[model samples]
Target: MKQGTIHNKDRFLNKVADRLNRKRITEEVQLPTWSKQPQYEVFDGLSQDELLDQFVLQCDAIHTNVIVTEADKLNDDFDKVIQDMGGGSIVHWDDPRFESFGLDSALKKQQEQGTDVHCWNYQLGEANIKKAEQANIGITFSDMTLTESGTVVLFSDKGKGRSVSLLPQRYVAIIPKSTLVPRMTQAAEKIHEIAKEQGRMPSCINFISGPSNSADIELRLVVGVHGPVQATYIVVDDK
Candidate 1:
């Protein structure tokens, strides 16, 4: 064995051996039980109605626009959002949920009417990234909406790429009432459960509260500094 390699191995082994008998280290470490409900009573007695109300209030506080629409009339509402923003190119996640909601068909119809629509597919490779970057609007589905923080959680999957939310000038999320959770703790627990069931977590899990803003430059509070300047959340009352 080379003298340098042997010395490195001995140093590593000595470091490990020194830590084994350290009296200052405690073996019984207690970590916060993230899966359990927090002891704080802020959300304890809140009803579903109260939660939704709080959610809207918090969203407004964070400069996020919330639109409530009936589940059946989502298509119309979606079209209204697009029209209000004017006809332009849109990029969206290619999830089955979007397909089931006929969003794909609606986009295709818009495309035939002279608007550009791009569905993100990994097969398209880097082209999808470019399309998302240049799109006027990007739409995605929220995995969970935390009522307390008015946060939307997005987990990247095969059909849902992170760029669909991060790359556009305007980002839109279609959230179902059923996906609403109480707070961040519950949301984390749900993500842990998903990981256990799937045997792995997604590569990226984004928690988005509102439009991106930063006060770093002269503390002037610039919006869309690094991300979409405008974000809209459409909550479908599927109940």
Candidate 2:
């Protein structure tokens, strides 16, 4: 990842340092020690399977479906999920993991069968958004998942449009077991580590839990007002 340059950054920093009556320090700052840390105590030292169980329970409360499958059967399971969701026009992020997980052939087969399948293309620009808006289902691999909130974190970029998740009628997240964490605290720490190792962070990070829900119109609950009406998570037991 390339670091983006900010114009007059040095001048702005120097002015801030002068106001603080100190020179600009370039050394890394140490994090503060919080005396009472309760966030980590929740679901502490749980096994991966235990975390996943908690995640599924939370998903049920939020009206999202969860499917568990093995790596060898992921292609079949994924295909079934799509078919169960009505198997119409589909849009997905242009990610290589689809090929690694043996879904490329499945998607290609769907295309051959006259099902409209669109992969987010950076070169196509707004054309990708238009396709996503008209798509019946949008699929993407979850970068990280928080068990406590049943939230899937998406690291969006050029080939991974946010519209693919927000504009579709239904949203599906493919969660590799290894990516599941206990809570958002762990997710934030992992993101911070990435920012430290790489020069730049992802362009967008979406924390989606379930289908869009609100109760603002006369206190009446509404689903799919702003985004997908249905959500599903396929958790693969992969290394």
What CA root-mean-square deviation does each model show from the true structure? 6.1, 2.0
User: In angstroms, how far off is 205's CA in candidate 2?
Assistant: 0.3
Q: For residues 202-231, what per-residue lDDT tens digits would candidate 2 score against the true structure?
A: 999999998998999899888889999999
> Candidate 1 on 1-239: residue-level lDDT in tens?
12232458766766777889643443578887667545445577777667878889999977888888886788888988888766589999988888777677678788899988988898888999999999989999898999988899999877789998898899899988788778887888888998888777887999998888798878888778888888889988767
The superposed Cα distance between candidate 2 and the true structure at residue 229, in angstroms, equals 0.3
Kindly give the stretch of ten consecutive residues in candidate 1 with the minimal lDDT sum.
Answer: 1-10
Q: Show model 1 residue runs off by greater than 4 Å.
A: 1-40
RMSD of 1: 6.1
Deviation in angstroms for 57 in model 2?
0.5
For model 1 the TM-score comes to: 0.84
* Candidate 2 local lDDT, residue 16: 97
Candidate 2: list runs displaced more than 4 Å.
5-8, 17-28
